[model samples]
Target: MDLNISNIIIASLGLVGAMIGGFLSYKASKSATQDSIKAQSEIYNKTRELENRRIFENKRTSAKIIYIDFLNAIDEGLNIVKEQKRQHVGRAPNLLPMNTAYSSIIVSLSEELNPEELSVINRLYGIMEKVRHDILNLDYILGTYDHIEFDYRILLVEVFGNNYKEMIETNLEYITRDLIVEKIDREYKKVFEKLRVLGELNTYGN
Candidate 1:
């Protein structure tokens, strides 16, 4: 009877030990599964962020290209205006052509810009609009006189002179002309410096 009791107790204890071991194994598996899920979630979030940054950078670069093109058109128009003014004693009616070209360029640039870059582009657009308004006022002044008289010439010179000054001062850092190209290059370097940070983040996981 004593031996049978001892055998039963030993059997019961072994069964209990097996149950506890099985429970611990299950708990460990659950914990590992949760950790794996959390790690995967983190990776997915990082990948999504990197993709967004890449898209933003590409859009910004595209907008910059269009802006640079528009600037080139503006410079060309300015050169034409200056040359025409120098050659003709009176207000030549050629301002309309130049103004139209500048307007078209601005329209093109505005269409290409993404919303993220719109603020800076809009500011530049506003400046162009002001320049256009000034040109229109100059046109009215010139139209009042039948021929390019001394007074009319002086008004033309003053208005256009101021316009040129404003253009030069505002765009000195962006103009690609050889004389100012070095300054523009420096400005471009700064732009790239900002871009590089974005680029590194984008390429990090890859």
Candidate 2:
């Protein structure tokens, strides 16, 4: 009877030890799974941060160049317009090939540029186009292109002389550089200042 009891006790002890080992193993497996999930979450966050940083760097580099060029073009174009207005003549070609500078800024950064800023640029372009049209049409109607230099002049004094110039000048006086250019400059400066953001535009029209 003693031997039999001893054997039973040993079997019970073995079963209990097996149960304990299983519980510890279950706990270890759960902990490992939790760690794995945590590791993946951290990796995902780091990858996203790197991606965002790269995007910002791209905007700071490429977009910055475009904005500066556009600004310079505006400044130079305005100066030329002011000069021509002083002489009442269009001596230079198409006011500095405005189409190129205008298209470059608008097209390349089409998606990135701000809606309000885009509106202002478009408005300025429209005004400038109207002024060009009137001057060029006058050149064609007067046959001044053939006789005199096909120049953009507030008055075709070369063709009509001073006395006849008043009639043509009246139509353009409202849209002259003096009358409208300052407003264009102001609006443009406001739009550009926003794009001049160093950190994120946070730059370029966010």
Candidate 3:
């Protein structure tokens, strides 16, 4: 029997080379898979961040619109007194719009709202309820026959000489300007502070 050390060494070398190749291939495949997973995770994070920003922006826009509408309604509410003095004016004399606007602003960014903001909102709701009660009392006095329309409002001032309707208007203006509007300003500033801060931070990046 002839023993060939060269051939044996060559065969051993070939087996080691194949083993090394397989190990390297496995490592390369694992690295590629890890890279793919990392890329997907980054993409998911970016997408989630963008979605969050979109939601925040939407909330901000909704808050702005509701606030503007409430301001307009407040203007209308406060103007009811002046409107009573006028002989003829467009739109009726009612706090319904303001009430509706206030209701609409119940909670847009509730998470961003502090206790003070919530308190002010409750106070404003209370004031609105008082205003509603006054209106109902007036409606009862009027017998709800024709409803509290514009003509009735004007007629009350003409006949009563700014007694009933004008008195209510004056009262509404006082409470709204003093309590409701004041608290609204204070609480709105505080409530929206976090939103503003987050918005500024988002401007940079995640």
Name the best candidate (by TM-score).
3
CA deviation > 4 Å runs, candidate 1: 84-206
lDDT of 2 by residue, 4-66 (tens): 999999999999999999999999999999999999999999999999888667656544554
- Predicted candidate 3 versus true structure: per-residue lDDT over 6-112, tens digit per residue: 78888999999999999999999999999999999999999999999887886665555444433444444445544443345343455444435444445655676
Compose the digit string of candidate 1's lDDT tens values, residues 76-176. Answer: 34443443343554434333222334334334435443444444334434444444444556655436423323322333233234343544454434544
Candidate 1 matches the true fold with a TM-score of: 0.41
What is the TM-score of each predicted model, taking all chains together? 0.41, 0.49, 0.54
Candidate scoring better on TM-score of 1 and 2? 2
lDDT of 1 at 69: 38
The C-alpha stretches of model 2 lying farther than 4 A from their native spots are 78-114, 121-184, 198-206
Number of the candidate with higher lDDT, 2 or 3: 3
Q: C-alpha displacement of 153 in model 2, angstroms?
A: 11
Better of 1 and 3 by lDDT: 3
lDDT for model 2, please: 0.49
Task: Give lDDT per model, in order.
Answer: 0.46, 0.49, 0.51
Best by lDDT: 3
